[model samples]
Target chain A: MPTRILKKSWFIKSIFFTSAFIILLIGGITYRNIDDLSKSSELLTQTYRLNVELEQIFSHLKDAETGQRGFLITNDPLYLEPYDAGRENINYSFAELKELSRNNPTLQKNLKDLNVLIDERMDYFQKAFRFSAVGNYNDQNFKENFYKGKKLMDTIRLKIKGMIKSQNDLLKKTQHTYESNLKVTPIFLYMVLLFSLVLMFFAYNKIIRDLKEIKASNEQLEIFKESANQSQIISQHGNWIWDIDTNTFKYSDNLYRLLGEEPQSFESTVENFMKFVHPEDAEKLSREIEKMITNKDLPFVYYRIIQKNGTIRHFKGYGKLHESSDGGKKLLGTITDITDEIDNLRILEDRNLELERNNRELSAFNYVASHDLQEPLRKIQTFLSRLEDKESSKLSEVGLTYIDRIKNASTRMRLLIDDLLQFSRTNRADNVFEVSDINELLESAKQDLAEIISEEDAIINSDKFPKINVIPFQIQQLFLNLISNSLKYKSKDRIPEIHITYSKIKASDDPEILKPKKPYYHKIIFTDNGIGFDNEYAEKIFVLFNRLHNKDEYSGTGIGLSICKKIIENHQGFIFANGKPLVGATFTVYLPIT
Target chain B: MQEDYINIILADDDEDDRLFFTDAFDELRITTNVKTFNDGVYLMDYLNNEESIFPNVLFLDLNMPRKSGLECLKEIKQTDKFKDMAIAIYSTSASEEDIEKTFVMGANIYIKKPNDFKTLKKVLSEVVTINWQYHTNGLNKDNFLLRL
Candidate 1:
């Protein structure tokens, strides 16, 4: 862009110079032509003057010859007086002709020859007059002298006429040359003027075009600066420039606003701006400014500033060295108000600490539940067992029934404690996920319920399974809880048959997986022929300690299915129970593919 | 007959658990000489005595008032005198952490305290009848926990 401007300026300069040169050429040509015209007129006047002088000389000779004739014929002295006066007049004319023809060599030569002829003629006239004065008109010598004198007069007349012709020819030649020069000079000057006018027109057009472009660009710059100001306000930042050469500063209007002041409210100087800096940060910022001045650059520097209203804000500043085309150095800088960001970071840190404390307390509770709570419950059950084993025969029937009830209650308490511990363990975040075989985990769960399976003669059938990513032990527990749930709720009339099936399914394909977190899931369905509860209790059964049947009919602590739900939740999966009264219960689990 | 009987020691903080341990052993048909300590401190003091006879099997309860069973197990495992004696972790709660820690610490087996007298007697007799040399040779993480 600079180069383009440079080229444009160069073109304007060339046009200006060429137009000036052409004007000068026209001026010179006009001056020379005027001078030539004056010279021609002067030549004409000189030639005319020379011709008149020659004619006067010739006429004077004629007067002298005529005077001699009259004096010889009539013997009058008056004619001789006329002859002397004419001679004096002739000499004056010769002097005038000599001055006029001085610059013309040919005219001077002709004038010289004419002078000699006039002299000879004047001498002959005088000799004749002398004879005539002595009354020698009748004498033969006087008569011969008179004829010779007449011939001399005639020759003199021819010489004067020849001089006049030559003068006229010289005047004509000069007039012709002057006329040709005058004719061509006006056309040449007019053409030059026209060319210069065209050149000026183009230059004017280019200047107009360049001015328009500059105006458009200036308007664009204005818009950009306005937008920059708005953006600075929006983004909580400001800009500044320090000219190193001039030791001066220019702060954008937003910079003043950033300092919580009206634009240009104060002088843009280091001291003036420093007055707003927080006392705690002034010294460090002054040092940084000093370094920036010396180095003409600044890295990120953090500081605090107190506004006029006494509000303190955190600020971060950075600058870079910018060298202008004129080789002047400046530091272009930007400062941002980061008070809100800092406060947010501090708030996040506090929240994180609080969360950590809560987690620690939860883990402590898990430990108490697993160890301390179970210990006493185990002793109670043990002592009750000891009582039954050692003294069952001696107890009355009523006392024995009480003992049995106490035993049932203690056993339920143990179950509840163990189940609560399992639920909390599943809540722990330390479980590591690994790729595990679903069939293997199912087999392990079935083995855990092996005794019950054999005693009840229950048959378990399952489809082939694929490996999936899961918390291994938690998934195994999930399988154990669900299968055992089905087994415990089996119909008294029918043998228990549990069918475990596995398949890959899209989350969208399963209506049960509402608000699916993943696209694909590993679907494992446990279908069993059991004494299923009403469908209304499907969701309720998973609630902790929520049981559909009384303790006399079902031995569930209402915790096993809750533990299963927790385990599935820990894996970020979903478990759904579907049941019908006395037909079957289907527990479908969908684990995310990832 | 005294030499032929199996020698056993149990360290538990609970008096009732100590009574249960001795009672289960008394009821079992296996001929055994059983000893019980109220806590790991008493059990360690007896085992550390130069004149005291090292039992064939030592049952260590994890939680105690002072000097927990884990501390005693670590001390006994380090001593050459107790290297040949089998150690069983007998705890009311069979948490995975305790099971893993005791297994790693060279306990021969981990038995969660059963809530019934019958299962307790069964577990004690089975532990007593185990061939120590054969069991130690085949000991692994899967078999470390006495599940039944």
Candidate 2:
């Protein structure tokens, strides 16, 4: 391409050469102008000098001729004084003319001739002065001397004219040469100046064209920079440029705003940026960044940050870091604010939890409706059976016996329904809790079970029970159920005896399904001398409707232990039964110490 | 000669509770004769009598009555003449706050009606055997006499 440009520029080159030639011409013309000025000055000087020399010669000659004529006219020796003075002066002038005529060989020769002529003339004038001094004015001597002087004067005049003509020729030649040179130099200077102007115009146009292209490129870059910044803001993205050599970082305005900062307000350094990150997530972010940096794999980092307002926000930073061969390793990245995305996820999680809670409540409500509703339904069934018996006729004994069984089954179903209702309403009891004396609570509970206590002939004994924080009515129900459970399950051979003992026991600190997560608990024990179930069934004894004895042997709804479990759980504690089958049962309840 | 000890009427709906109360009264052996009724409606029906015996003591169960014990107590207190009758409220609940409110309603004593025979005896002796103010038409200014 460069060769193509060079080849294509031949026309331009011709123009350039033309312009160059013109410039050379102008330079030469300018130099020649100065040369002409010097030459003209020299010419004028020569003319003036020659003129001056000619004037000196002519004046001296005139003085000499006049003096000679005076001497000739006066014929007195005193008049001869002018003649002698003219001779001395003409000699000095003759030498100057010779020196002035050196540049012209012809003038020099003429000057030599004039000098000889003046010498001859001077001699003739002297001879005439001698004649005037010797003869008294005799006609022959006077005529002879006068004629000699005139002839000498005429010859000297001719010589002076010849010298003047020679000098005039030299002056005319010098003037002609100077005028011709003056005419040609101006034309040459004008052509040179025209060419110089053309060359300057071409060079100036080239500079301006290059500058225009450069300016256009700069404008395009400005537009590109502006759009890039706007897009970054809209996308919640920020970019960073680190000058590895300077150990400095520069971040975009979006990064500042993501951390709840104004455009001009935040520091975007990596150190300061780490400060905004959540401490728990910082290590993870850093580790990921480090791994990416070390491996040059350029992995993306998504982590949580705490904004200036103390809200947990999520941020994602993605970019590649490369080693700048220019001398520093720099890491460049883009950050995105993901707070809204994280908040939406949290809301989804909360909604799922709410859904689960609602599902549990709905199922519990259904269980209560089906289990507790049986009592009234069974009563209605029994009444219906009794009414059917009143209308019965022509039935076999077997059929009658089946109807009686149905009535008995309905009666038992009625009792089961009542116990189920009690179980469901346990949490709804409006028992105001206070610092109830456990001693008083136990005594009252024991007294309330009067029929059972007497019928079973259970010898009840007690010890000082620890005061605890509990709902008194609920606890009373708890005691009544447990005491009844013991008496109902009494052994046929063993005497029924119930023992209640209490101490500030440090309960097992482990948390159970319904137990409060506390450090310690108060253990209360109620031991009974009744048929205790096997240890394998100890955990199952607390389930609703879980019974070891048949209804014929021990009359109970089997819901007593379940109620006790609910109350114990409500008190933020737990209860468990421990015993062997046909031996005895020991139920211990743990209550929170606080 | 002693105004034939005041007749105090006791009413309850529960049969076992009534048995427990009667046995307790027998065991305590209080001189004041007590009458019993099945419900507060029956007791109120008797109280409305114009020519009937005015009982000296009335032991009412709160849980009884189609009108409730509070309503009966309100009726008794509103009638100025019967206000002097020593009324005791018997209940299975031992809430102290309930006893406080009953006293504020002009009850003479609040007794926890026991479910156990032994507890009933103790509660009966404590209520019927305790010295109580006997109302007369013109008693002395300092004291209304009570037989301890």
Candidate 3:
């Protein structure tokens, strides 16, 4: 389907067609009027000729009568001569009238009667002249002849008058028709002219409208081109097309701007384009381009380019191979100056490396503090023990008390350091995730605290555990810390009974509990009948070095729960603790079942 | 002449640790003779000497100045002469990497050096009393790391 241009040709075509039709119509009307006028003129000329012939005939008959009357009264030869000339004139008029009315039956009949009358009248005239020449003063037959002549003249006058009246009527009818035809032709012509003018007006209006529309469209196209160029400049993008048949390339002005060159400054050949690429990337780019053109397979290419200003920039170019309408290959593509993006990525990578280094240094510090720091503290305690064992009797009471205090403080320091080590180890541990049997992890955790379990007479009731993908060692440590915490903080009135139960919960079922949103999680709850703190300290207990009870009340460095929290997090899971002052505490761990 | 008595050796760079270790053994009243080396090199030299008797239990400290306990453990396990010697990594560091490495290197046992003298005594007694043949025959990573 062809696209519809803003300027419509159909309007112009319609106008042309209407103009032609109107001109043809006007020509036809003029032609028709001229034809009708000519026909009416012919009819008028025939009527006029017939009327002239009738008038001549009537005049001649009157002259013959007058001449006959004179010749009879005085018996004169001049009168007789007038009668002879009238007779010849009447005969010529009658022949001309007959010839004029030959094609008309009615006119021919009238002329025949008029001719008989004329002949009779001439005979009467002759008789009168002869009778008078015989010298008869008065004759009865002559009077009768004069009476006949008078009557014949009257009859001839009436027939001539009738013919002239009929001719006059025909002329009047033809003239009326010619006048009406002239008036009607002009009115019809004016109507046709008015229609043509209207058609011309409509055609002209449509043509002007189409021209205006075309102008507006051209203006819009100019604005569109400017905006496209502006957008390309802003986005650091430029488009190009490579025509294989012509072996020529068309580059948008922005492409030249991207290369730090004036438009049309550089020749657009493959080798010339490669010259702009960074030396290290040029060969690979050349090979890739060669492969793309040979195989007609275009893939995205990202490389470094050296601009005309000697600045290195990263460019990402991608195009598609297409067959032009003329069976020639063409590649149309866009190139983006991705230097800023590359810089950002490099900065991110550098920051990541720095962060990893910081992490390594921090773990190193933890290991050193855990191990090396213990050496001196252990020495102090050991030598103190030796001093106490070897010289207890010599020491005073205050000295012994001071020594015990020092030992106690050092022991607490050792425990704190050990807990700190455990806390840091969660992050420093191996990151290999495997499918480990939770039952075995729990069993090992139980074995680790077997001595305390038996000594405290703690009853550990646990449900069967499911196997899960996790860092087994970290999970074991997590279990150990929670269980040890329960035993250490057991209620005084009862044997410590810790219930370990776990159930798999879907993310849809327990949205609040599994906050991080995994498909499946093991909600392992460790509910103990041990000394629990206020519920307000539930979140606080998970914080490093956050102790709910006094040191004397709970023998802990307060790092145990924090280590548990870290371990659970390592497995991409969540840990929560709930406690009440006298009631037991429950530590719930959510581990993803993956 | 003294085959019945337990012979224990400790290799440590820290003089106080060596003193404390020997004192702990002395206080325990176990039927044993204890010897101490300042570093791993000295300990290795003493064990290689044909004139010297092989200790029933050898306590190797991981972080010594001359040579690391892991390197010594590797050397001893490779040497046929030290096959009868029961190797124990007694270091203040309880890092899993150290323990695993020492275990893989054929160390008989791993113990984190305790802060209190009583813990040290208890750990040493338990280690010294272990049936070396039986322990070595069934040595596993699980039983290798001995926590005090």
Best by lDDT: 1
Candidate 1 steric clashes: 0
lDDT for each residue of candidate 2 in A151-178, tens digit (9 for 90 to 100): 8767766666665666567667766787
The TM-scores, one per candidate, come to 0.82, 0.36, 0.68
**lDDT over C-alpha atoms for residue A514 of model 3:** 34
Q: After superposing candidate 3, which stretches have Cα over 4 Å from the reference? A: A1-227, A264-267, A270-275, A283-298, A454-463, A490-501, A506-515, A528-531, B1-8, B24-34, B47-56, B118-129
Q: Predictions ranked by DockQ, top down?
A: 1, 3, 2
**Candidate 2 deviant stretches above 4 angstroms:** A1-404, A428-432, A507-516, B1-148
Tens-digit per-residue lDDT, A1-594, candidate 3:
012432366766777888788788888877877887787677677777777767776776777677777877766768767667877887787777767777789889878777777778778877877778886647888889878988987788788788778877877887787788788878887887888788788877876766677788878888988998999999999888888777788888898899898877877777777889999998888888888778766688999989867899899988888895558888887899999998999999999999999999998898887877877887888788778878989999999999989988888898998888878778835678889998999999999899899999999989998678888888899889999999999999999999998888886788556355578788889999887888888899889988877897777998998988888878888888888877899998888876
Assess the local accuracy of residue A484 in candidate 2 as a C-alpha lDDT between 0 and 100. 81
What's the candidate order when arranged by decreasing lDDT?
1, 3, 2
Ranked by TM-score, top first:
1, 3, 2
Here, model 3's chain A TM-score works out at 0.68
Question: What is the per-residue lDDT of model 1 for residues B67-123, given as tens digits with 9 covering 90 to 100?
Answer: 999999999989997899999899887888898999999999999998888999989
> TM-score of each model's B chain?
0.96, 0.77, 0.94
